[model samples]
Target: MSFAKVFRTRSFRDVRQALLEREEIALVDVREEDPHARSHPLFAANLPLSRLELDAPVRLPRLAVPIVVFDDGEGLAERAAERLEELGYTHVTLLEGGLQGWRDAGGELFKDVNVPSKAFGELVESERHTPSMPPSQVQALLDREANVVVLDARRYDEYHTMNIPGSISVPGAELVLRARQIAPDPATRIIVNCAGRTRGIIGAQSLINAGVPNPVAALRNGTMGWTLAGQALAHGSSRRFDPHVDDHVRLVSADAARNVANRARVGRTSRDEARRWAGEAVRTVYRFDVRTPEEYEAGHVPGFRSAPGGQLVQETDMFAPVRGARVILADNDGVRANMTASWLAQMNIEVYVVDGLMPADFAEKSSGPSARHAPTPPAVDELTPTELRTLLQSPGTAVLDFTTSANYVEHHIPGAWFVIRSNLEQALLKLPAAQRYVLTCGSSLLARFAAPEVVALTGKPVQVLSGGTNAWIDADLPLEIGETRMASPRIDRYRRPYEGTDNAREAMNAYLEWEYGLVAQLGRDGTHGFHVI
Candidate 1:
């Protein structure tokens, strides 16, 4: 019998009550991104079964924390629970009826990814009446060369892809820290924008909260609104705020940010207290270095993961899935952590900013991927890139790519079939009969875990590409592009209408309409424990 049969289950009411009462619970959606986005409870975090081992240890830290896993109808919930059990999770339970159960029980299901953070952004705008300027108005000012500065409150990559002409990248949490320097003149008009709405409103409000002496407004609906108004966006713009800040500006920014955090009842803890909290087996504590990725890779605290402040606020559910868990944020500068904690506190999360840490304290350093606590993968036969290339020439040999659909479409070994690890059984039935099989993904870490399972299913010779697709690329081998051979549907990632430049006008308009109604939906759902100050 499967271990899933032995596991207990929680009804929708039980999970909802836990969230309403602010009790600790991780209502995890174990399906891939597309399915989860189509329908799911408001607070459910998407932790796909394919990447569970890679993310679970970091997102859901405590083994004893109550966890309720679910899937729409793909039979992934039980498998996910079993995997969690094998990973030593003590309190794993399946959602009684999965997604269907929630719907039948009158639970509100949300569409799109990052629902909590996006909904919170809408709520913030409703409550604060965050000021905004339409794209045309901002464009007029820019065209006339008025005393206005456009600050793009998105990740650097997002900003580089497309941005308002003459705008500088000042990602969300950095607004308060860097805004003064970018527009030192107090009378200059400051406009913030994101791909859609969340970061723009949050960034503009952050400057207001920090008591910056400038007029501020968000670019309404961000680049989407700009596009709707038939405005052209500058591509490949690389303008950014200077990292260096004067001592006076840093001190003022720190004081103002701390004041906002204090108003929101965000706590401050010493490193010792934070360490104690992390050591508690009963409590789930997430330690994050809310600094830029480049800075984090240079040096950071020993246990803290790199979660840039802007993205953390934009996707809180992704970083800390277990609702009501303790979250501790760190940064060498005093501004970023406190500013980020203020937002988390208003979102009803128990958050803290670490105090009394100097540059010397960030002793631990890494120049590679963040450390992950995945289970030891089963040993499998390995093949070098040259060997795989030689093997591909032989008949009756098949190569399966287990990377994301997006990556597979971008580039892969010639004639490789794209497959989803969770649906491998069905995927294999679509492939031609082969005497041997080979598995590979981005870095071979995921492929290593799937090799044993494939070997068991195929009952044939199986091997993994030594370094996965990256190694093949390094070998300068010929590659193919597009969805040439797809064994499974490309449902691993949901294409957000707000990302990239080629979005349809209808989809972009519909996305804005959805955001407009989020506040009303929040009221209807009644489970978000938010308290905006």
Candidate 2:
């Protein structure tokens, strides 16, 4: 059969109708993060062409699941669709007319990533009227040493970077499980804050939903509000919630969280049942251990990947791009998984919690990174760090760094030029002609995949740097920092207003204003299946 006959094209209306009906579908944008963030369908998850081979299996678990790939005139969708088919995908289609078709059909293209989760947060605040306190009131309470405990509902790294005075890092899903211990006094006011609004609102509401005794309120606009009010944030704060909860507290928290989950209509499944679902050929089931990364690394179920509950909720599209697929969360303590599942349930996902698991059930233990599945890279000649250094001294030898723009700016080989993997053809044309080329990314995994492509493009002696740039760093080799030599534009990452410490005041205000209007936008789009209990 011809390629066109095997892989058909899907129109914007067809994709939107499928989403509205909650049918299984993966609407993917094949561009890099920066372009994808500039505009895309509300549910379009970014699976960039550069890392598609590495992330496809994990993000889209079912090979036969329907997938519609699109690109905004970058000429990447058809190539991506072909790659998916090469990777054994049975059902892959191109989006008709690419991203422009969606615009022509009057589809709403959302800005920034994680639109669904952020929009859901806005909806919850709109419907439940989740209580919030502006920065001024919170500051006034803190000045007088009021009976309050501040909890930062962001990752530890973000908390360490900048935080409210005397705030403890409790993250989003951790709030319900750790609130009582952090503020044992029922009279103590509990305030939740993130860099911005979403996590703050969700964390405060999570505590309230779990029936915590203490009064809770979101720090309105989060740390952004604090900063805009001329309040100085404490940097390098180390305070964090203790993970070791008492047995009685664990049981109580688990009961409360489970009750919340039940109210949200989340399902419960046994380990055996979850395995059965995973083994089914017709369905896609993602098994995740929804615990802190440290805890997950120490011990976890064999097949479950580590997905911290807070991040999973905040970045659901990135974690599970196949909308309407079944998600099974495994948490030994029970509170985190149940609470996280409650939010996912309301997000119109078919989510379940693994019931009745003992500590012994988590037999697999690892202190390293989680396992990822990808096609074996084509064999290419590799030059060790020392050998590459020697080769660079000679003429007609060039190095291409396929790492992220952020990483390239931070540190890279002394003379290596930054290049985007998907845009290699154009980038190579920009570089001076060389007799031989060397490819390296942060870990060389991407470089290995790009070696054959480089050979096919230039017919040159293309080789990968052994162990990648990281190995060079480990070898005490000199490195370069900043955008020194760029063969391609740095469009791999999208800088968010909430990230980093030096964001302009105007940008921060604009981000909060954008979030405020998400509820209305969600209504106009009319595809999200979110609800509030």
Candidate 3:
């Protein structure tokens, strides 16, 4: 059947103008979280094609309106429309041109609350807020520049390849948790850098969100930009790690233990209580509904604001700046949100965990969001061999070696592939068709997250080696531990320079402001644009 028969459609330019005019249109985007972050049209809300069906029941009611979706390419748009139709929605349309077609139509693109793109833009244009040292204005200040801390927020391996002379290694993903360790002196002007732009900007802004006293900014793009500005990149590695974890900030409990289910946090309340909180005051209690944004907008607790679990945990101070104020963390799936609360508790922040608390949309609608980020915990103390062995028996069970590819080559599991924390998901996609998914990280945290993503996408059951690779080794499992890699990945590097061959001046200005404050500005737009296949 033709997709057009199933979906109404529109041109990108038409949709763009409609959004700007604030017409009653429901702009929907169907793409994964990360890709949506990379690039998309302005004002597109991400529903991700995979979640279109699950979200439709709630999705339709919010929009007594029209929805438009896009895909990277192929018939994904039509397929998605079909799924939406199955749920009985009748008003969605496809973008006439996929992202590239829109791009061809002079379709302006946005990084969609993307920190990296802003950071990269900042790196390219140095005319912004970079604690300037123009020869004449601050010659003496430059001479007396004895107090500044620089951090590199790219992957540590990238740090090993090349870094700024005195910067510290802090992965962007780890910034909010480890910021204090990197910049102990709140008085210091904290500067962040990355190999390119995004991580540095995201990292810097995350610190500000966490309430770091230092005025944080990206090093205008990072080592790449530094080099373009006639600076040299350094070689060799530096000590990397948060200086320390607060001993007092010990884990009261970890994982999906029963205690995790009952833990308390500030904003969280019983379902009845949450409904009451929503009625009391919209601004007093910052109720963060920790579900995907699509799920939130379709319907949420009346007074609640939207913040995903991972981003919220990493940016608590930014969302709720008033310390000692209340915060409620909620999720459709209770366990993972509770697991998060366990960590937040040790962070010494007052918080709460509420189960069965949902938006008013839940009462009005009958559907749910697609697979949530929650991990289902089995009701068992030790992982049973039966479960473990079944996961191993599947030929397609992905064996991800968290160790470096080099370590992988030295002798790892025979069929397992090498995937570092930074690039694990991208690799998972190209794996041979598998019946189930298995993962190995140093411990279970990475697996806990990654394995579930597969389930969400492919609906496959996933398990990580219980103790990670160590568990495999402890059991004396048989397979290659270290046998030199058979081949190297065939990949090349490319750079997209500031192609100002044709662009409005306002965009260029926004790009410049973005660089100076990349860290502090991610997702501030509070809207999204995306197209994926």
Worst 10 residues of 3 by lDDT: 491-500
Report residue 194 deviation for candidate 1 (angstroms): 0.1
Per-residue lDDT tens digits of candidate 2, residues 122-173? 9999999999999999999999999998999898999999999999998888
Candidate 2 has an lDDT of 0.91
lDDT of candidate 3 over 1-533, digit per residue (tens):
64356556788767766644434455555655456556666445556564443344333333224667787673567766766665555567888877777778876566634332343334323323334222122222234775666676665666877877667776553455455555567777667776545455445544543445777777754564555455556687675765354432222111221253344332346766755653452223445666555556666654455665445544443354322234566655453355445434533345676765544434422233332222243321224334555566656566655554444655565677765433445666667777766666555444554555556666766666677665666667665765433222311111123221233445444544545564333234322221100
TM-score on alpha carbons, each prediction: 0.98, 0.97, 0.42
Residue pairs that clash (backbone atoms under 3 angstroms), model 1:
none
Cα lDDT, model 2, residue 3:
55
Deviation (Å) of 351 in candidate 3: 19
Top model number, TM-score: 1
Ten-residue segment with the worst summed lDDT in candidate 2?
366-375
* 356-461 per-residue lDDT for model 1 (tens digits): 9988879888653343455787788999999999988889889999999999999999989999999999999999999999889989889998888888899999
| RMSD for each of the candidates | 1.3, 1.8, 13.9
lDDT agreement of model 1 with the native? 0.92
What TM-score does structure 1 among the candidates reach?
Answer: 0.98
State the lDDT at 216 in candidate 3: 72
What lDDT score belongs to each candidate, Candidate 1 first?
A: 0.92, 0.91, 0.51
